[model samples]
Structures are given as structure tokens and as C-alpha cells.
Target: MGTMAELFAGLLEGVSEAVAESTSLQGNHLLELAVPDDAWRQVLCVTYRLERRADVPANSFRLSAQASTPLPFLVQVMTEDQQLINQVDFNGGPPAAAISGSLTSYNGQILHIRMSLDGNPLVFHLDLGQPASAALSGRLLAFTLASRPLPATPENEQWPRSVTRQAFVLGYEDPVTGQITPPCRTMPPALSSSRVRQAFLDLTNLGIRSPKVFPLLSVPTDGAAAQAFRDALGNVDTDAVVAEMHQGRQLTATRTGSGAYTFRFVPDARYTGPRLLLVETYQLTSVPLSYGPGRVIKTFTLLPGERTTMRVSSYRRSSQSIQSTSSVLDSTSDESEREFEQAVTAEQGNSAESSKSFEYNAQASASAKGSWGWGSASASVSGGISGSNSSARQEFAKNLTSAVGKNAARASARREVTVDTSMDMKLEEGEESAVERTIENINTSRTLNFLFRQMNQEYAAVLHLVDVRVAFFSGHSESREEVPLAELDSLLDRVLNVPRTAEVRRQILDLVGATRDLTGNTHPGFVRTQAPDGTELAPAVDPTYTSDYTTPDGRTITLPGIVTAAERHVMRTDGVTVDAFLGEGQGLDAYSTGLQEQALRAQAADNLLKEREADRLQIALEIARDGDQKRAEAFRTLFMPTQIVNQIDHAAVNTAPVNGKPSS
Candidate 1:
């Protein structure tokens, strides 16, 4: 009865064959099937031939199927004892049977069959159509039981379908190496619902029946490439290999009947040398249609019971080889270093050249000097005589003795001297012109005034020997040895032992106090004093007493007791007049009155000058204030257009002459 039903179902199979042959299922493809009878079984068969075409890459094609019928009355291909064998279906109007098993006799094609009913057993079979490679053979077996049935009705009649997906084991023999390379198998979609129970059942069936030939491809095993495949798998088992070609790295393994069997490999081909091999698989399941802002798409990933594939190709590292290609880097660095050194040397050479030029100019100017020479022989003799005191005096005396004789001689000599001096002056002027031309490059005021100030300050402590005063003295008659008043001991005692002036003492005390504030000590040694040379000034003697002394300008200065009492006096005695006729008091009174009058006149002049200056300033200030007021008025007038309009309106209102009512 099952065989007849199978035949009848096969005859009633729809045109899905043409659809499957033409269209490729990428994600989930939806199809609807009708059950003529509620109790009748419906079977679906999906067979696909996976071919390696020159255009299509490896592991590019796959096949899977599903049904939308109840499970109990499902039309399927199974045995009478409820054990699935080949192709069969339940009694229905046409006994719809799907011929969906393996297309390739070996592992080259895949077939997936699904049965939908309230309660039904799915059956499947394969037709290679032609003899296939012996290495490409696979089998279909059933081990897991189908799910139990539930009550069904016309409204809720459909039951999730059962599917059987099979992957054929196809192989090819290398002509040279004589090693067989297994054919690629399509991967299965990760199963989410129990409707795909038949698909996994199919896989286990094939694996158990033919453990040696069936291959499970999985992600690559190499640590580097494995992550990529694992990521591709997403949430799938990374350690398991699903399916692969024969001559490839083990991707995943499965225990069929007893022992574990490899299901896939990385490189699918066995090569004497090296070759790239790829194994691919995929999983198909009904994914809920997801809707976003604008579009809807069916998303999928490599999952268990789903189809996935892996590929391996020949590879080599080129980074290291490329790095080693350039060997002259050190030589390039050395050349760069040499260039840098040359640049530095050139800069230094230029600097030295500039310095040398300045030095050469300075030396050339220093080698030249300006000088003046005596003009005439008489002038030279006079200068010599003037330099000798006795000759100068004798000459003056002789001239005084013969005044007329000297005057006549002088007149004649003056004429000759004037002529000779004029000629000699011309000669000297010519010499001076030559000297000016020679020494024209010299800097006359190159020394800055600030630099002179610094030099003076620096040398203030150095006393010139010529400026030092020496005192001469004789000892008492009782003493046999003559004593020099300017002895070194006496000089040291007078100069060094002298007490500081009151001002100096106050400065010292202030310095000491400042030092103590900073260093927490009042010791004199801690006080810092500076000399002209920026050196610390050491006290020549201990500070014993402080006194004040007047400066040379008669300011009534004060100093310590040890300060010398040397009053500075100018020679005003020569200017003192001898008024022998006037009494002392009268002379003094006259001088005082004269000084007072002069002072009063000077004060009056100063007051008049100040008054005139004030008047001038006041006039200028008044003129400026008037000008400012005029400018301010002009500015106001310039910006008073609105104000003028308002004023016109006021005038028009106030000065409006009544047209007919005005009377005197």
C-alpha cells in the first residue's frame, strides 16, 4: 500500500521541480501547500544537484525543503512499520509525493524532504539519474522518532513539518597523486524550531549509515584563521566540524554509529603540491520577517543543523622580506650626519670671518696716529726758553729794561712772525688734512657714557700713588732717631682705624639689622657690604663711636670721633678787598646792604617772571576753553536736525496768527 501511495504521490507532484531547478534559495523561501483532505498526508521532496561550474565558486549551491501540512495525515515516503525507508506518502486525493533525496550518488548533491500533517512519518529517496563517482556515494537512514501528534481542526489544521536534509559525499581522484578529493557538501541552516527535526535526522542518518565517506565541514583549525570562521559561524558551535571536502583540514566531526567521523575540511582537495580548496554549507529555517523603518529583510547566520563552508588557499608571509629589501639605511643616515656637520661648520666659519673682519679694521685704525709739530724757529726757541724758568724770567726782565727797544724789535719781528706763521700754518694745515684723511675711520666717541660710569665706579677704590699725600716731620731733641710723619704704621692707623661717619655708621647698622632679620643673627660679620669691585667690604677697624662731619660744601657734616678734622678751604683771601679808610663795622654793613639789595632785586625778577608766566598760561587756558565751547556748540548744531524740527513745530503752534479772530 505504501509503494502504491508513493507512486501515486510521485505522479501528483507539482511543478516545484522546475522552480527548484531554476531558482536558488538564499535565505528562507516560503511556499504554501494545500491538503485536499484533512486526514490525508502530504509529502514534499526537494532534490538538488550541486555542480562545480567554472563560473560558480566551490560550495556555492545547496537545497532544502519544508511543508505546510498537518503531521498525522501527512503524505510522506516511509515504510509500513512507521520506519522511514525511501519515498512514500499517506492516502490523499492525489497522494502527493515529493521525490527529494540525494541528486549526486556520492557527496556532490544534497536533498531535503519535508512532510506536513497532524501525524505522519516522512519517507525519502534519491535518483542519481546517471552513474556517479564511487567516492561520491551517501546513504539516508532514520534514527530519531518523529514528534507526537496533537488535536487538529479546520481552523487550526496545520502542524509543523518534518524535514530530511541529506548531503552527498562526492570525491575526485587526482591524476598524478592518485589521492581522492571528496566532493563539497552543502551546509545546513541552524535549526531553531522542531520543524527542522527531520533535517538533523537526515544528517545523523547519513552520518551513521556511511561514516567513512560522509564529511563534516567546519571552521578552520589554524588559530589565526579559525577566529574568522568562528565569527562567521556566529553563535554556532566553534569546536564542531559540520562538513567538508576530502583533502582538507578537519573542521568538525560527528559520531555517527560508534566512532567519530570528520564531516568537513578546510582545503577540500588532496594535492601533490599545494592547492586552494573550499567547503561551504548553509542552514535554512523560517526566520520571522523583521521590519525596520523602511524595509524588511530575512537575516540568517551559520548555526547548528545549518549549512556552512570553509576554504583554504596557499599563503606566504611577505612583510619580513619587504622589510629586508632596503639595506642602505645606515649609509643614508651617515650621509645625513655628514651633511649636518658640514652645515654647522659653515655657520662657525662665517662667524669667525665676521669677527676677523672687525679685528682687522680695529688693528688698521690703531696703527695710525695724529700729531702736531712746531711752526717756526722763533716759536720753537720761545717754547724752549719758556720751559726753562730762569731763561723765561731773564727774557721778561730784559724786555722790561729796554721797552722801546723791545717794542721796535717786536714790531719788526711781529711782521716777520705773522708772515712766517701764515706760511707755516698753510703747511701745517696741509699736514693736518693728510692726517685727518688717514685717521678718518677712527671712532671718536665709541665709548658710551654709561660704560665710563661703570669704569669709574669699578675703579673708585683704587688710589693713584701720585694723588697720595706724604707728611714730613722731625722727632723731639731727646730722641736720637728721626721719625717720618708719613710712616706706614701711622698712615694705616689714620686711614684704616678711623671711625666711620654717622651716615656710614647708620648704613652699617641698617645693613646689620637687615642681615639679622634674614639670617636670625646680629653679628657684624653677617652684614654684607659691597666695594666698588662688587667685593665684600671688610671693616678696617671696629666701630667704636659715631659722629657727624660736614662735607667740604660747609653743610656741617658729622662723623665718628676717629674721622680726621680736615676743613676744605678755597683761596678767597686773594679776592678780599683792603678798605683801610672804612671802619670794620662800616665795611661789613656796606657789604651786607649790597648783598640784601641784590637778593631783593633777584627775588623781584623771579616774582615778575612767575607772574608773567601765570598770566600767559591763564590766557592760553581761557582761549582753549572758549575754543572748546565753540566746538561743542558746533557739534550740537550739527546733530540737531530732530531738535530743529521739533522747534519749528513749536514755533508754528505758538506763533500761529489766528486767521479771522485776531484783534489789536
Candidate 2:
């Protein structure tokens, strides 16, 4: 205190000592805030308004504070729309957003939060750092952290900072293509044990055991859920059942709606680091149990995510299995009966005897004729009688006397009687012959029967699918301003949604084209055709609504050519026409063979033409040589007349004047 500097220093030391004592006392007082049945509790709420820091994705924000000591705490984040986004680190530890439990800090640490942001204000609630009485110690204990907000123009604006947003995408990166494949927007309906049990029960009750689920795998997997199927199905091969599900089976599934997305990069002052993209991939398998097979989705978690393009793997879209049966029965029967009978008898004999004979003869004759005409008439009459007598004299005389008396009183008895007797006679003959056939009760019976039975069964199945494809083909999108963490879920939903608009549009166009074709309104003027020489054919004639619709091979022939060919075929008269009947199966094969044979015949005909031309050429060459030789001989004979005269004279001299006189 001897000088002014000493005096000022001494005063400052005293003041500093007093101030330190007061701060200690205040801290002790705060620690004593806990009272029995009335512990101290406090809630802190803060609102933050995020502003665009640059022209980039600025949807991320950070909340940070310093904890004086470890404590039990709860923190909540919300958006302007009051949408709750749960975020927790358990007092500055690892995040535990998926866990639903109270959070406790282990030791004093720095409290921090990082999350997505949006255009709206963010509200944060901190419920921590309050002193309460210890049950055993009967004394107050405190764990506290203090934070204060900075003022801004807006009521919700605070000093919390925001930066470029970071997003994570899950997909598969193709090893071969060096591209990323996004997850499928739609997944098959989950098959659970309960559902399987229900389905099995239904099948059993309905007696429709042929029904099957498709694309089902047959494998074992970890977890009690996999074992649940066994309890439902008894005495059946679980693995076999699951494996058979996808064999020759069909299913119908619809894809949910989604949009196409792409990603591009542009330099942004606000973007500090690249966003995260996880390329995850998985395979679907089946696990067999008692009741039925179940689906198991296996995923690989350690795959790297450094690709730019991705593809999606998917199951088949549709499948089918067809089964059919046919049967036939035919039967016939017949019965019949008949009967007949016959008989015949004959006799022959010869005998000889002697006897006296008497004979009386008488004869009479009469004739009369008359003719009349207009101018002439003629008549004539004649009569005569004749008689024979027996050998007995009395009988002969009686007959003769009666005859004479009747014939005429002037008959003068012109009767003649004679008797004759034979003493010996010879005869040769058989005794008797008889034949009897008692077929009078003839009877015959017949029976016939025929039966035919047949049965046919058929089964067929087919399944096909294309890999998962993008329904939308647009580019990726990003907001320039911050997007709230609460709204991030919606964005992801949008990305996963797949729409049927593109497919529907294609189907509509196809249907329209088909309709036009059916109506014969396919714009005939626009239908172009080409000739064999590759020149464009003339435009189609006026639309003639003839019954002559186009056949499958109609396009193969020109209109005029086909017409002429048909006409020629119709006009043919010399060719043999054969009508054949063909049944199914082998008959069809034989028919096809016949058609091939016909084509071969046509080819042979063409070859025959070439052969004929060759033969004609050979014949023509020979004829030309002969004609050339003959022409040369004729020219020699005509040009050399002296040779002809000399030849004639020599011939005459050698011939001895042809009958001793060389005349003329």
C-alpha cells in the first residue's frame, strides 16, 4: 500500500476472494433444490429457423451443448407441422432411435444432434439435468446441462446451425456391370406360418390339393419362426413340399406404383461432404415346416457402396400349370334264335300175274261246220262212234248189246268181243325207300357283346419373368433448401412408389391397333407393299369390303399373283384329283410329310426343265455339226464342176458302157 498500484492490486485480490466464495455458495444452493415428495423438474423448449446457406442441398442441422455431468434425459424433435421425429443418443452416446426406453448418460460429455431440416421451424425439447433426493443417501444429487438460445428476427429463429443434407439409399451394386441396382419397389406378400396354416386347412377341406404356391424355396433357416411350419403340417416332407411349390406353378402379382430416379453432381458451396449410399442385396429362399413352406429373405450387410448405377432383381411376374382329363365308354349286346324240320318218303315195287282178258270195241265220230256271210252260207255234218270190250264174255256181250240198241236199230250189231290171258310175266323192282328228317323243331341262338373304355390326362406348366425394371425414367431430384427430418420419410416413400402408367399406356396403344386391324380400317393407303424386284407396289385399291379377309400367309403373295394362281389351279383339267381323309396325331404328321414331298416334287420339276434344256443343247450341237458338214460338201460339189464331170466319165468307163452301150 505504499503506492497507487499496490493499493489497486490489494483491492482486486480481496474482491476476487469474495466473488469465489459467493459462487460456491450459489452452486451448493442449487444442489439442494431437491425436497422429499417434491423433486425439482424443468423443461426447456427451443425453436430454430433454418436459412439457406448456399444454392445446394441444405437440409441438415446440428444441435450441440455441453453436459456438466452424466444424467437421465429425453430429447424430442418436431417440425412446423408438429410431426414428431424421435432422435436419441442417450446422453451423448450412440444413437438409439430404434429402442424405446429411457436414456442415461454414463459420464459428463458433449451433447450434440444432427438431423435433416426443412423450410419450416424446428422445435426441440430437452427434459434433463434436474436434482432429486437419493433414496439411500437421503441427500440431493444433481446432473445438469444448461443451454440458451440466441435471438433472431423470427420468433422461432435461434442460433443453431444448419448445413447440407446427407441422405442414404439402399440398393444393389452389380459386380459385372459396375452399377448400383435399387431395391424393388414392390415385394411379394409375406408368407407367415399362420397364413400357411390357414391355406393348408382350406386346401384340405376343399379337396383341391392340386393348388400350389409359386416361387417358393425349400431350405432351412435360423429362428423359431422357421420351425413354426412343422407344427402345422404333419408327416409330410417339408423340404420336398417347399421345393415343389415353384416347380411348374404360376402366380399373378401386381407391381406397386413408383417413380424413376437418377443422381447428378454439381459443385455447391454449401455441400461439405458426399451423401451416403448403401448398396445392399438379398436372395429369397424357402424354409419348409409342418404346415407348409415359408419365404426367407437373406441379406448381405458387408457389401461396399461405391457404384453409380444399380439394377433390381425380381421374381417371376406370372406362372401357370394346366391339368386335364378325358374319358369315354362304349358298350353293345345282341341275341338271336332259329328252328327248322323236314321229312320225305318214297316206295317202288314190281309184280307178275296171269288173268283172262275180254275186250269190246265201239267207235263213233261226228263233225259239223257252218259258215255264214252276207251273201253265202255253207254247212257240213259227220258222226262216228267206237267202243272197246273186256275179256269176260258176259260183260262184253252186255256192253255190245247196249251199244247196238242205242247206236241204231239198223246198226246190225257191229260189236266185236275178244278175250286173252297170259300165263307168265317177269318184273324187277326194289322193295321200298323212305327218308325222314325231323328238323321241324330246329332252333338256333346267338349272343354278342362289345365294350370300349378310354381315359386321357394331360398336364402342362410355364413360368417366365423379366428382371425388375424401372417404371419411371426421370432424373433424381434434390431440394435447394433444407428439408425437415420429419419429412424425409415421405421423400423416401415417393422414391419407392412404382406407377403402372407406362405399362397402361402401352396396353392402350396395342388395343387401339388391334381394334383398327379387326375393323379393316388399318389405313390401307398407308400399307406399303413391295414387288419381287424390290420396287414398291402400287397403292391399295379402294377399300373393298369383300369377305376375303387376309389369311396368315396373305402377306406372302401379291394380290394379282395369288388371284391368277388360284384361277389357274381351278381351271386345271388334266391333273389327277385325289381326296384323302386324315385323322389326328400320326395323320397330321403324314400330312406334313406329304406337303414336304409335294415341295420336293416341285423342285424336281424345276430340275427337269434344266435337264431338258441341257439335252436340247446337246442335240442342237450335233445337228449343227452335221448341217455344217453337209453344207461344206454341197459347196465343194457346186464350186468344183470339173471334178463332177471327171467322176461321171470314170464311172461310165468302169461300167462297160452300162449294157455295152455308152449312150449319151
Candidate 3:
């Protein structure tokens, strides 16, 4: 298979042939399933009848099979084959329980999946041009691969260990240096357009337009440092949208009596992968002075083998401010319009990451002046709700920087990244702008916009992948055992049907290798991403949200999106920040030249209208004096042009002076 899409298609064929036996492609709903836990057969079979959701066309995009019930949520697979089979003892003594596998390639490679562990199968990849930081193998243990074979005991005495040893390391542990290196977990494998569409529906709790389904690319933003913004500045047209979806119940308290209620979350049909469910409830017992609306927050991860999570939340807030007289209380008031938001956020295996918030305002003030004393105290609180550093290769950034000749004025880059970067977190710490108001909660697209300046730092990015075939009997190992074709067929089918992140790491690294530069603002830049024909990419379109929640609040309480309210906020663009920064028909068009043109056109029309009004008044005066239309018309023509000979530019006709002065 030349591409990831082709690779998955080839795998789906194998799975279809093995499961259905006959390669009849009619009414196929092809899919590579990561088998759910507690499956009966390492090799099992069942007969399934087919049904069509829609009438087929002459040519249609179809899957290999469609089950009556949707795929269930996947739990960790438990089997007896996960143990270490062979040994590679680095010290020539005992095989370390965990080994640090290296690529033996050059240092600072892009997307280096440096190490892996047995339990956490996801490969942890390092960013390009990262520092030469190695892990230390501190301690040694009798690893299953390196240690001598254990003597066979009675079945009841000890359980059998799994035997699947893949040479990989999360990182090297340096005991002497006392350094504990860490790596990012492998990303999810490539997904199909259909799969992504289905996942989008499940994650955002929204539907898509018909006949406009584009292939949704599975992008990785892990370890990428991005300052979250909610404004339209960075909104990409025809781009993927990442939103964190919440599924739970809403409960409220009564005026009195027991005020408690609970809601259970249901798994979505489209998202059959791992899931995380967070349950929460906000409580506000009364208004201020007697305000019982309280707030609480907690985070939760999905537990293995668990389908549901249960949580209980209870809160109350009461406060009062009063102006006091010498012996009695006076001028007391209650706080009004108090609101609280209780959010339950669960990011499922990176399906999506999103946030939601509520506007909360609490204010209290009291003042008193008497012979006893004068005192004043007031408090006001406004509730704002919210919401990877992908690094550049050291070599790429340093080398490209020097390429800009000394004659060229070097521009400083604040932060530069590809628009396709799906989701990211900021790696730097700072206040974005001292003059501009900082957003507190940035969940909306409007509020998430980052103010940035174009810099001279330029970069080029590319994505590429390569695959090589190896003979299993000889290449996989030195011939520990031989297998039958039937078993071999099943294994091949299983590999294709499952999502393996190792493959993803390889592809991402390949992309990094192909790219000359990805992100940075060190050197001066005038580069723009272009097509093969050298046409610059089109301007980004306005982004759409999963849903607009601020409409209900209206102008009285302006509630902005929370996606941008990220603690770390700001934008660093590849262009300048001035009015003339962008060229014709580019960004800032609506607010810049667009506004100037309208104002100028209006002024020119107003001047013409005044001239026309003067001509009409002059014609009326001439007609009234001469008592003839033709006479009035001739008088008007005398002032046809500005340079007329003997021109006396009089606005209206007049009679001879009655005494000393002429009168109209």
C-alpha cells in the first residue's frame, strides 16, 4: 500500500476474507475492528445476515460488514500471550524487565518514538531537534526474556505468564545521573473519512451536512505548546474542529425539602473506542446575603472494564452586608443575579478536548458614617469560564535561520506553527498583552482569538510515510518456531484489523524527516504555504462552533466562548501586526480598506448633490424673471463649464436694483 488509506484498505480485505470466507463484496461494510475484551475465540466464527441502510448507487463507498448492534466500547485485552519470549541483556547478566530500544539513527530526529513499556503499548515519541537527553537504566531485574526458564509447577501452584516481547523502550532511566526521562504516549492510528464523520457526531453531539463529507485527518498535537484562542483570527476554513463533548444529567434544587437528583451517561454509537465519563452538578441554594449558589470542580479518567461512573455534588453560599447605626442595624441589602456552573469534562483517548463555563457575578458593599466611626468595604466577583509543545528539530531551526543573508532585515518570530495543527497547549509562560484585557474563560470561538504580529521566521512542513516488507520466519526472529498457513492467515488478519500506534509514530517521523522546517520565528521570513504551482494557500474561512451558548445571555451579560479563556493565551503570527501588514484582498480586509472605501465614496456623492441643488435654484429664478422656460434654460447654460468666458457665477437670476442694490 502506497498510502495509509491504501494500507488500511489492504488490511480490511484480509479481515473480510478471513471472517466471511467468501470474498463476495456485495453490501460490504468493511471495518478493521480492535476486538473487544472477553471474546470467546482467538479464532471464533458467527453467521450474520445483512441489511442495507440506504439504496446503493452504481458505485458506492461501502464497508465490509455491518453488525446489527454497534461496536461496544473497547476494554484492555487480557490474554496469556503478553509475556516476554526472548531475552536481550544489555549487561550480559540478567535481562532488564524493561529494555530501552534505540533506532541507532542520528540524534534529534523528528517524531522519535524513543521508548515503550509492556503494559503501556503506546510508543512515546520525541520531538524533532530535542536536546540530547537519554534515559538511564538504573536497576536490573531477572526479566522474563533474559532470566533462565522457570521450572514447571502444578497448574494450581502458579499461573502462566504471557509471551509477547517486542523490543521497545519508553526511555532510558539513568540511575547514576538521577534523571527520569519521559515520552509522549503513541497517538491513535489513521482513521477513515467515514470513521471520523461518525466520531465527530459522537464527540460534538452534532450532525454533518449531506454530500459534503470530507476525509477527516487524524492529527497529533501531543506535547505541542499552543496558546489557546477563541477568536476568528486563527479560524481555518475547511479545517477539522476539536470539541470536548459531555454526556450527563442536569439536576436542580427545590425552594425547600430534599434537593437531589442524578443522571447516568450513555456511550455513543459512533465512538466505540475507550471512553472517559465525568459527572458533575452545580448547586445554588439562594441569592446572595442569602445566596446558596455554590460551585465545585473535579477531574476523572476512564477506568478499565468500567462502563459507567457515579458522582455526587452539593454546595451552598450565604453572605450579607449591612450599614450599622449606633445601636441598631440599618440599610441592609441582598445580592441579586447569582449564577454558578458545574462542569464535567472527560477527554476520551484524545477523541476530542473541549471546555464549557458559566457567567457568575457576586458583589457586596456596605458603608456607614457616625460619631462612632466611618468604614467601608465592598467586594465584587465576576465568573468567567473556560476551557503540546510540538518542538522543532534543533538542526532545522538553526540551519534555516542562517540561510537568511545578512543584507536581509531579520524579523523576530513570536510563535509560528502550521494552521493544520489540530489542537495544542502553550509551552511558554507569560502575560499575552499588558494593554489588552486578558480573557478569563475562553470556550467560544470569538473570545479565543490570539492577537499576533507577523514575524520574519519562516518554515516549511510536509507529511510523508514509507513501509518495508520483512519475512517473518527469518526477519521477525531467528526461527524460534514454525506456524501453519491457517494460523498465519489469522495473525495477518488480526494485525490489519487492529490500530497499532507504532505504525503511526513511524509515519509522523517520516513526515518530520520530509519537512525542512515546521515551527519557529528565529530568522526573517516572507514565505507562505503554496501549491505545487506556487499559488499561495487561500485565506482561512470563519470557523464554526459545535454549538453557540452565548445567544441566550444576550447583551446584558455577554458570555464569550471558553475555548480561548485558557490561562496561557496570545498569538504569534508569521505576518506583521500593522494596518498595512496584509496585502490586497487579505486579512483585516473587512475592517481596513473595506471601511475606508465606503467613507470616501459617500463624501464624493455629497459634493455632487450640492452642485445639483444650486443649478435647480438658478433655473427657477431665471424662469420667474423672464416668464419663459427657454429663457431660463439659456441662462443656466451660460455656466456650463467652470472656464466659461465672461463668466459671472451667480447662483440665481436678479432684477435691477430698486434703489442702490439689486433684488431677486
Which predicted model would earn the best TM-score? 2
Most lDDT-accurate candidate: 1
Which consecutive 10 residues in model 1 have the weakest lDDT in total?
Answer: 451-460
Global CA lDDT of candidate 1, please? 0.25
Reference-based lDDT, each prediction:
0.25, 0.22, 0.21
Off by over 4 Å in 2: 1-232, 235-507, 510-664
Model 3 alpha-carbon drift over 4 Å, by segment = 1-140, 145-664
Q: What is candidate 1's lDDT per residue for 360-457, written digit by digit as tens?
A: 12112222110000011121211232223223222322322232122223222211101111112244332212111111112121211100000000
TM-score between model 1 and native: 0.14
Candidate 3 structure quality by residue, lDDT tens digits, 1-664: 1243344346545554232111100000001112222211121111111112243221221112111222211111111232221122122232222222332222332332211122423222232222111111121211111111111111111112222322222122233432212112111111223333454453223222211112111111222211111111133221243221122111111110111111112221121111111111111111101101111122222222222222221111111111110001011111111100011111111111211110000000011110110011111111111101012223212222222111011111212222111122222354131122212322211222222223221111111111111111100011112222113333333222234323322332232222221222211111123445978652111122111111111211111111111011111222222111111222234566667678789999999999998987887786897799677557556545343243476444444344556664
Candidate 2, number of clashes: 54
Tell me the lDDT of model 3 at 661.
64
- The residue-level lDDT of candidate 2 at 95 comes to 28
